[model samples]
Target: MRVLVVDDERGLTGALRRGLTAEGFAVDVAHDGDTGLDLATDRDYDAIVLDVMLPRRNGYDVVTALRAAGVTTPVLMLSAKDGEHDVADGLDVGADDYLTKPFSFVVLVARIRALLRRPPQVRPAVLAAGDLVLDPAARTVTRAGVPVDLTTRELALLEYLMRHADRVVGKVELRDHVWDGPGEDGNVVEVYVGYLRRKLGRDAVVTVRGAGYRVAG
Candidate 1:
């Protein structure tokens, strides 16, 4: 999972970066709302952690702009204002979920997991392909009921491929979405696919001859 945290509080953002990273999420931090809005607008993120009180643009305006621009990624707005209307204002502007100041990290993670599973009728929280299972919330992967430990990058790559299971995902697509962009190395995707294959099994991810890669649904 990828999360963008927009907050002016340096200490809080620092702690969030470390904690969320430990949970198998690729996290980016922006100290102010303008930067946050830019990152959210430009990148494809699984979720966003936005702060209401900000330096340039407040969280409300940022979310409003994002919705107007048609970026429908889930947002969990953070605020020190715990009043009834304050919470309403955050949701009213288009935030998927809201969290007040001094909130528990566990609850925040749970709320994010819940948000990811939105609409309930579609998009299962836990992803599976045959006997391979990936629990995004727990950041764990298992094959045939046996546990597997994957590096953060490997997990992200596997999740993206599995999310679009059975479809050919091009190298450029994986580079943009998984690596965030092109890197100096041209074969990064191939290298990581090799990493996943060693752990998951040789047949887990299939390569399309003229296209890219696919994970069986």
Candidate 2:
């Protein structure tokens, strides 16, 4: 899964990025709300860990703008204010979830898992093709009862293809969904597809030559 961490504290932001990355998530960081808003506006992310007290623009304004612009990716608002009204304000501004500072990483991970389970109104969780199965919530994949291991990026790409199984998923779309940023400038999609093919089997994912790729039964 990919996540954007928006916090003004450089130390905290770096810590969150490293910690989350270690926990099997592709993470991008933005130190201030302006940069955060820009990245959030420009990219496609599974979720956003937003801090309410921010420079340039506050978390409330940033999230409110996102909702206004119809960016429905889930946002988990982080704030030092643990007051009832503060929580209410965060929700009122359209944060999908909220966590206070001095919080446990375990709780944060749990909240992120919960958000991934119910990904806004966009991508759904479970996807399947024939006997092939992927459970996004569990981060698990199986083919005909045989479990398989996939790297974070591999799993993300495979999930994308599986969600659109039998249909062509172009390189740009794959990059947008899986990489969550611009200009990958490498054969990452192809390489990860190769990895998936190796783990899932040679006949699993099919490249559409001059088009894109597809996952088929």
Candidate 3:
């Protein structure tokens, strides 16, 4: 799963990044709210860990903007203020859950998992194409009733393709969404596509020739 962590504290963000990464999540961190807002809007994240007190924009405003822009991706607000009003405000603005600072990392992970499991208004729980099946929450993929072992990148790539099955998705589009950022080499997308084709079968993903790729609908 992919998660975005938005906090102003460097130590906290770094620790969370390392911990979440170890727990099988592709985590992106932002020191301030502006960067967080941009990333949250541009990329698809399963869940967001947002700090209530942020620079540029507060967590409440950020969540409000996300909801206004129709980004239904779940958000878990993190704050030092553990008062009745603070908690209520976060939820009222659109946060799905809230965690107080100096919080347990285990609890945070559990909350994130819970958010990911909740039904998303914008995305499906599972994606399927042809004989392939992918469960995003479970992070499992199977083709023709047989399990397929895929690396994190491979699974992310397949999920993105399957979500847009039947449509030609450009390499740049895939890189922007599936990858953290542009790779050092431009052939990264090609390399991963090759990996997917090998595992899922060549006929699973179709090349549009000079344009991009499409998964069988």
lDDT per residue as tens, model 3, 46-110: 78999999999999999999999999999999999999999999999999999998899989988
Tell me the TM-score of each prediction against the true structure.
Answer: 0.84, 0.87, 0.80
Residue 129 accuracy (lDDT) in model 3: 85
lDDT tens per residue, model 1, 116-154 = 777522457899999889987787999999999999889
Better of 1 and 3 by TM-score: 1
Q: Where is the poorest 10-residue window by lDDT in model 1?
A: 176-185
Better candidate by lDDT, 1 or 2: 1
Q: Which pairs of residues clash in candidate 2, taking residues 3 or more apart in a chain or in different chains?
A: none
lDDT, candidate 2, 89-169, per-residue tens = 999989999899899997998898778767564556677888889987778999998999887778878877886785898
Assess the local accuracy of residue 106 in candidate 2 as a C-alpha lDDT between 0 and 100.
78
Off-target runs (Cα >4 Å) in candidate 1 are 119-122, 145-152, 175-188, 209-211
Model 1 Cα RMSD, 1 decimal: 2.7
